[model samples]
Target: MPKVSKWLRRWSLQLRWMFRYFLQWRLRHISDRQLVIGVSVLLGLGVGLVASFLLFTTRWISSLLAETPFGWLSSLYFIFPIIGILLVRTYVRFWFQGKFQKGMAYVLYGISKRQGNFEGYHRYAHVLTSAVTVGLGGSAGLEAPTVLTGASWGGFFARLFRLDSAYRVILAACGAAAGIAAVFGTPIGGVVFALEVLMANVHANFIVPLLISATASTLISRMLVEHELLTPREGLPAFDYVHLPFLVLLGILCGLIAAYFMWMSKQMTQWELREKKNGNRLFWEELFLLGALILFLPPLYGEGFEWLDAMINHHEMAYLQRSWWGHWLPAEWGIALLMFLVLMLKPLATWLTISSGGNGGAFAPTLFLGGTTGYLMAYVANHVLHFPVELPATMFTLIGMAATMAAYFHAPLTAIFMIAELSGGYHYFVPLMLITAIAYATKVIIQPVSAIQAAAQKIGAYLPADKDKAILNNISIKHVLERDCVPVPYEGSLRDLVDAIARSRRNIFPVVDKDGYLKGIILLDDVRSIIFKPALYDKVAIAELVHAPPAVVDIHESMEEVMEKFDATGAWNLPVVDEGRYRGFLSKSNILSVYRKRLRWQIEHFG
Candidate 1:
């Protein structure tokens, strides 16, 4: 065993040395921008293949279950989910130490708290877990897991190549763009999502690499996988100008529904957390609830993309095929009733799937609800209310999908372009723009932050959307601390102080006692009068010259608090102390300098 360990250490050292040599050679030959673009392309291709595999695997398993042997066992619908969730639970317990942090929330937390660093298991854990969960009708989407897998790879490569934090985060965002583009076949939408949701601030430099990555991923995914999940069928009608007013009304409704979506999801999460005790009792309860929901609501099965596709292509009876009471109601209003029920209950199924140890994302669920909302509105208005002209249920379904996505994610552009791209063109581009804008605006007024931001805040690692707070939050006080300020003994004479001043470059001097406790500060301006009279330098004590600073800065204070202190005291520099002992001084100028450097780095890091 010792010999094997020694051999492994030797090989690791040799590999690191070779990597460093290659990095040096590459640095001499290529610019940072060129290297980043090349890496982005590679990352896109790799993430594209992985995303395709996840999609393909989940769909294949789902298809196999929907066929003869498995399909015949409709009475035992819960069997697949039982096996899938059990496998995921076992996998997570042993492999991840029961710390299976999946989805967009985990990714956002990584960006905010870990400098875009992800655990090694993140690259494959979500893919393996989510495939089983969604494949066996666990009632969630694969997009979030795919995004996390892409982000993990991005962080992995950045660390492998020894890139800075700024570059690492940007590369991670690029990976996310690649994942989305590959999954949905929407390159531009993927780029917009990365910019709007993942990255707190969008710099000019992020555009090119994000575009390149998304394009590459889309191309690779197209070559490998010739399927799409949420795209509407062809031969759809063009947008009519007369439906603008109804579209606005639909937007308002979707905004309200978006709020409900977020609220219900939060309630479910809190309930699960509160009841996470009693020796697997809560798990069984959730499993039972999930089975009941899927048994009645067929659209809640798997990612629900197939059901969404059925709605898009006008397959109304698909919602009632396997349900107990679905056949009891009339065909006309039965579809509307089921659509409404599915819209209301989908969030619960998603919560159950995830809380019961299934791995998947809410991206698909949001779209499912949105499509349901749109179809319901158009169906009721045209058929029940007997509108003069037939309102296009197909177009409304597409619009609702975009509106709810915009509201929930706070990404209007992503929703607009994503729906347009999925529908195969920008034929309804103007309607998409108008409704998404309204929905986004309404949701923002109701809830200040998006669901992702709220999740990040819950973990105490939220990066604010405000540019100033975001920049200031990243600047640590330790990094900006000036430790070069000279200290003078409390009993020392002015002559000694003058001598100390001559040796030190800083004008502020911290006075300390025999026990190393902070006495006070001695500013150069306060002693300028006595310094010229050299005869009194020996007579006057250092304690006489020292006085309390306008404000004292604690070493542990945040940069924001330090700035507030600087402003309130109106002092150029303040003494920093810890537990009444003198440490150093903090200068307003130094803090500003560091802040500027960080802000500049955020904007122009590639250069």
Candidate 2:
């Protein structure tokens, strides 16, 4: 029996290797464009199916834990959460080599800096950690973790197939889009999110891949989940000109709250480092503090999705229902008080979950805040102020989702499209546009840069997803370098330099030694007088007038970097060096021509 088992295992390994070799053979033979799109669709389906499994598993575990024999202990709500957090940190610290990378910011960094390469371990790392974090009643959700998984899939396929860095980046983005599409069942919104938040742009070449991936993933996710998480609206809002003023007010208020969330997130993110520097063990403190804190704020525990559902349905939510002081609190702590607490505490709890090493995304938190804010604001107006006109609170909740998301990420299209897909139609397009615009404008007016951009700037590695710049970053300096510059020897006389200069068509001259080592550059302007003087032409050695001009461009430098040198030195051209040898020269004009041609190709072909 033992010999038979070993034989079976050996055959399995051989079969797997044979299959992988077959894939590699095809990857090497097929056209890249067709192969990429085909693989991307398959990857999208894989991400969506995996996301659905995670969704089911987490929800099942969460429900089982909350409704089991010892369910009453969850009223205390702090014990299992402590166990959950401890287990998560312990696993990450010991098992995963102390690496914890799961969030939107991390994904953005991978796209902009690392060209979408990610470890296979991280795909499961984020899923497992987020499952335990949010499923075991941690104050977060799974959208961001799912994104990491999707991106990992994209990276895995690209790397396995040996795709170029640019293709890897695009597919990684497609993975992210597929994840969002499947997770939210919002394909258009997912595409926009990939463009607006992940890739940070909608390039012409990217639309086809993103659409294919998102659509495929959404189909798979919809099949697995069986229903939409955010069902579209059946009817339009009762919104008219009368609601405009209040809608504007809601937008401004949501912007302020968005700013507050960003500030709190930044502060909480740094709190651990600050505590460690002060000789405090923040890990244990974070666990204990979160445990103690959630015990008092029951609404802030878990993903808070159920609580949002109750609010949307206008059901009596449980704030002080299971509170430590449940007996003493008044019964009047109903929907209004619950609404107020959610608005106030959701942001803080989200920051706690994210900063304290719990894995999740801010999407759910931002949406919750927006919904509660709009719902509560309308509730107050109708009940407290006795406004002559009353509007539907649900409309406010839906539009507020977009407004807050836009303000938080400064991605208007993503927020708007996401809400539109959620609502099932564009019946409320006017209000959606107005609310998104006002919220985004207010946030931008107060803070010129968005939260993620601000964080990137702090790290001194800001990566803007501009099309022209992205292309320039990939292009090599050698491709456009001017090798036609005639070299002049450092020891040559003015007459000898003049003879060489006459053979060249440019103003700049590279001064090299007898052994072909670059000494410096001598501009024609600097030696214009000495070259024209008949008496001094032979008397002057070019070595005496060796003036180091602007910066030198390396053969390995990217065109993006070469342009920075041009801007810094205010020079039209610079010398290029290869291992201290004078390789060639690079002019700003020559580089721009190449850039324009590439840009045109990208637009025409990609679009």
Candidate 3:
């Protein structure tokens, strides 16, 4: 009967092991590239639907606010300036309080640190704040927050499914692409944006999933919005060959303007960092200040989100023509000056609005600034040089958009594709590429880091120089282990072993023979098991308590192999042996501690 019982136990163990092996095999199969692509597409579709709905809802609400009986709600323009102040206060306070906030910085951190495992709360806060700020006519856009939401969702899903780090990063990129595709209804732009800006790498491996997800998301968004995506006007007046020189000259000027925007963004972020260090205010206070600033900006307050809608639909010129300033101002001189001033001020305003805790993105502001710059430059070129370019202003506007974005973000491809998508594939590829390249080159010469990179560095989370190095190769048990010898003889008592473990701060001990050869391993569990059985504790040799055939490792083995062995054996410590003699025991606690310290150091120094 006892033999039969033993046989049953062995069979049960075998069945359990087989079941686990099958489960692991299934999981491995699911992590293949095909499955990842499918999942990304599905996620993109869902994101697109959500983004389109949000865009429509925000526009509807803005319209309703304008039409209210207190039509004076339109005059709430004065409130935006105050809101801007509050936004700054929020950023400052939160920064000082040590709460890791979400933004592009966090996205970068996730890619580098936790394998895109972002905290959900951080993302949620951004969404809530951005929505409220924009809803209240804060001079900002919702694109950043929307993208963050999608990325966070992707991160959460990847973690939940136990996907590898590489896949998680890819999924996060996919989610961001989906958000952009949905918002702009430009799948190509979305894909390129992920590669050029977020990943900063355009390898074939990333492009495949990015394109698939972006296309899917854009399709879904179109279905939800039930509106044709924006496209540039067709059959516009063409530039004469005589105007080519003027366009090239205009590109150079746009590059300079882009450099200014990038500089202003940096200064604003630096000021925020300085203020946080001084402890003058908190993040919520910045939110209040941002609210006040929103109240003061007339252009931001009167039309509100309607302006963005107009810009997207190419009806912005109509609104401008109807404005009070447009009616009184000289078409050439006054409007040109106003545009130049606004172009110079827009980046600063965006910085103030965002720093003060206003919920918004940089995308809308960049577009507005680019259009304004382009208009001003075109007017000057035509009036001063009598340039024969037809619709030179529109050409400059598109170029400005790409140039400014490329300069600020240091992402030329993303800037180019984004403009292309927004323009509905307008045939300005030659000019756009030229302007984007020049702007990128100019910015690179002027500033080594971008706004996102600078912000990330300030917040203690920066990307490593060599990110492609496998994490396994970088971390090793041998590197972390202490090179001291401590062991227990086979005859040692449980109490003795316990005392030694406490003093050594180790959970496992190597039981060695008199000749200093490793006999077996005695874990904390072994001590606990015999703790109440005092008679056995004293009488039983450590050998009797030890698990035989200690999991052993050579000093030169890779950490990856060590970890794999540790996992397979389910052991917290493994003995290090030279030949047949026990050298030391490597504890999991030590390995983990080293890894944590390294991570903390990376965050503090590099970030």
TM-score of each prediction: 0.83, 0.79, 0.68
Worst 10 residues of 2 by lDDT: 227-236
Cα lDDT of model 2 by residue, 1-607, tens digit: 9999999999999998997897778767886666788888888889988888878777877877775332357544776676777778788889877776767766776776567888778677877888888887788778888887898889898887777777788889899898888877889988888888767655566688899999999898888775444552345455688889999999998898788778777777777678889998776676666776677667677876666555555553355565555546455435566567668777777776666677788888888778778878877777666688896777877777788989998888888888888766477788888888999998888887887677655643345366666677656776777788888998788887888788998888899999888899888888877776888888889889888868988887767678999999999889988888889888888888888887786666453
Give the poorly placed runs of model 1, Cα more than 4 Å off: 1-18, 68-72, 231-234, 272-281, 462-465, 484-586, 601-607
Give Cα-based local distance difference scores for all models.
0.83, 0.77, 0.65
204-286 per-residue lDDT for model 3 (tens digits): 66577788878888888888774343344453345455656666666566667767877787776778789889986756555
Instruction: Order the candidate numbers by lDDT, best to worst.
Output: 1, 2, 3
- What local lDDT does model 3 show for residue 85? 40
Candidate 1 residue pairs that clash? none
Query: Which 10-residue window of candidate 3 scores lowest in summed lDDT?
Result: 296-305
Error of 1 at 117 (Å): 2.4
lDDT for model 3: 0.65
| Candidates 1 and 2, the one with greater TM-score | 1
